[model samples]
Target: MSDSHVTPPPPSPSAGRRRAGTTAALIRAQDTAIPQADRAGSGEPPTPAQAFDALHAYCAPALIRQAYLLTGRHDRARDAVVRAFRLAWQRWPEVAHDRDPAGWVRAATYDCALSPWHRLRLRDRHPDPPSDPADRALQRALLRLPPSYRRTLVLYDGVGLDLPETAAETEASTPATANRLMHAREAVAACLPELADPAALHRGLLRLGSAERSPAPGSRDIRTAGERSIRAWTRCALALTVTVAGATALTLETAPTHYLAPVSPGHAVQGLPVPGSLGPLSRDALKLSTKLRKEAGGGPERLVPQAR
Candidate 1:
């Protein structure tokens, strides 16, 4: 008889989300090593530039791996890696001067991962969700852990940061961070048997980073999406300002009508009846009135409506 072949089962939805979230978190953390403004700067020093290039050659792969191990999402990892390199270029002076640049990068990555924004994303995925009975049990165990404890486990056990380094990154006292690290280790150790093997996990991370390097067919549209997101954020702010100005204009335009509408017998419709050039007071009054009307929901829907 021919040998029976067994194909591996696919990951469950919750498991996939957990892996994706972790990978996303790690990549984002690494990206944080570089600052944003520095990415757009043009000036360069020849020697420093050479050093930056060399440092990036070594750091990029390690950061990519660290990101994959933290997050399971390929696209996010790529973006994070690019962003991290940009940041490293900006602060080459201080970073190159560090005793251990690798250590500095690791510390930067951890802080980014530990940020509130990253935590919120991970929490939304709930890394250990209740899908299978094994997953359920794992989720329960993880839930019982404190945030600090979880941070310690991911930093020390997952990425291999030492106790002292982890402590400095976490900002807990050396003793306190060490204590948290110990508890995190214990918590994860108790649950490992119920989860996939660490070797299997590592392989999956490598695949994630590689997948990012070479995106799948028909997904190149992501660059368009990135451009659109930047435009959208910019336009949203622009729209808000225009909305405020438009509202002010409408109020001012209509203010004369309001006062003119309920004029007592003595008070005449002052100023030119033909609606001549508006004086500064009239203009200012019109602006103020438009603002009030907009505030009162009397304007166009282009504005994000505020509470009355």
Candidate 2:
């Protein structure tokens, strides 16, 4: 048998542009689908649900691409984007009210991809080797960089986020963000000499960014996950309420009651004397006893008032 080799076709120049146009169209379509009732009369944004749908349609692909660049795996990237979107849906009101919902989603996606909860699972799945020389080199170089540097590069260059926005997304001070970007560019350029020029690096990243086109998660899956999250949170709240109520009830049941004690020994009058049964002095003593009993819980042994 003779050995044979086949070469893949070159990527279309228009593919990236087409994808961009399609994403915009999807957003427009989602906007058009929103019911008129969902919009406010004062030109405010649509309802959370409508806003979420539109934002998801428009930004999901780009978010997946950004995640893929960060994690270097398509499956992990998709999972991260899905989880992030689910969270966004749950916090739709806040997200809808944000000045930049897409930026919020991007930040959430980044956090999801790097969350410590996935560390063990991520370790179990080995990454596939890149077939392209350029990609292999870039991936290796990226893997060598710390997460902060990698994220800075991916956000600023690959995702086309401006410096301040990139800083906000990464939760870094602006100067720190700039420093990281500078270091990342130098590192990547050293690894891939062709990317030494700033312009070339940006162009290369844009090209690489456009190559990722993982399918957006279905609305059904996102909705289901959002519902599950809501149910879990509600169950936790109910459990807490029950626990607090039980503790309060138990404490109340076991708590002691208090009573006032007698002010003096043998001063509590047992009964009233019969009329004409006592002398004048006895009658005066009885009147004093009644007054003392009214002032204090029990009558004082001495009827004389203390001098001020």
Leading candidate by TM-score: 2
Candidate 1 residue lDDT tens string, 1-308: 11123222222222322223443543454445344555546744334544544455455666654554344334444445555545444555777777666556655654454345654564334442223454344435544667567556555544555555667767766667666655554565576643354444334333433433423212113334444656787999999999999999999887765344565577666676675675566788889887868663565566656568
Kindly give the stretch of ten consecutive residues in candidate 2 with the minimal lDDT sum. Answer: 1-10
User: lDDT per model, in order?
Assistant: 0.51, 0.73
lDDT of 1 at 35: 47
- Assess the local accuracy of residue 66 in candidate 1 as a C-alpha lDDT between 0 and 100: 54
Error of 1 at 116 (Å): 2.4
lDDT of 2: 0.73
Pairing residues by index, what is the TM-score of model 2?
Answer: 0.66
Query: Candidate 2 regions off by >4 Å?
Result: 1-29, 32-47, 122-125, 254-308
lDDT tens digits by residue: candidate 2, 254-302: 8877766768656566688766664466788989877877874365646
